[model samples]
Target: MTPHYTESSLRQPRTPHIRMPPFTGKEGWETWRAQFEAIANRYGWDEEERLNQPRLEGAAAQFVFSQLSPMC
Candidate 1:
């Protein structure tokens, strides 16, 4: 017999648990960009994750949010 899909069962995130280090603007942009691109390439991040997963935190994250609209 076939099975039915429930809301709870359908609620799994496709992204993995791996998290990039939070960007605090202390690191050089070139070095940070390289690492970010590398991880995204390795993990096959889609557009949404690419925009949202820069790992910005604290004031840096707030600054970004204030500067731009939320995507996720």
Candidate 2:
């Protein structure tokens, strides 16, 4: 005999999870371009701003490095 299964029991609710950027093809480039401006604005990381700023070294460099480090 086959085991019984209800529709509600068969369907599990999906939990939301963070996803990485699909950085490969045309779709990826479009996604990046769309998101990049917002991200850059949020972090004040525009190209001109970066170019105008003094090059950081020593402790300043370390601080910037730490800021850019990925969290586990």
Candidate 3:
């Protein structure tokens, strides 16, 4: 026997598009942008830094590697 679908099951829920919190004003935006740049620069790596690394061989290693990679 086959089960029948209800209206609730037939429709997917809508997800609201959330806007990121706006910068309060120009000064606030500049401050935030500077902070972000500092953090990114602290973590960013050059290609040469990556090339010397050993190859990852497992899922866990790959996950950690991804977290360190800029692509994340």
Candidate 4:
């Protein structure tokens, strides 16, 4: 007998489609953080997934990278 495959059974996880708005600092940090959290919730990301970090761009990214670079 041959195996059966349904549409959903053949589907991959939805993680590939996640496209978060990068943190550009044009909006305030609070706003961006809220969006980030919302995205996490939408994707049902746990603490580990949250720690993976969303897209951080521009001056904010630069500052954070600089601060953390010492530990790298």
Best by lDDT: 1
lDDT by residue (tens digit), candidate 1, 1-72: 899999987965566787878887777768888998998888888887788777777767778889888765
Ranked candidates, highest lDDT first: 1, 4, 2, 3
lDDT of 3 by residue, 1-72 (tens): 899999998653232232233333433546755664454345453454323322334554565556676653
RMSD in angstroms between candidate 3 and the native structure over all alpha carbons: 17.1
**Candidate 1: pairs in clash:** none
lDDT per residue for candidate 2 within 1-72, as digits (tens), equals 999999997753232232334333334445555675555455555576433333345554566667787553
TM-scores for all predictions: 0.61, 0.30, 0.26, 0.64
Each prediction's Cα lDDT score? 0.80, 0.50, 0.46, 0.78
TM-score of candidate 4 to 2 decimals: 0.64
What CA RMSD would you report for each candidate?
3.7, 14.8, 17.1, 4.6
For model 2, the superposed segments whose C-alpha errors exceed 4 Å read: 1-22, 26-28, 48-72
Ranking by TM-score: 4, 1, 2, 3
Compare candidates 1 and 2 on lDDT and give the better one. Answer: 1
TM-score of 1: 0.61
- Model 4 lDDT per residue over 5-51, tens place: 99987765546677778887677999889988898888888786777
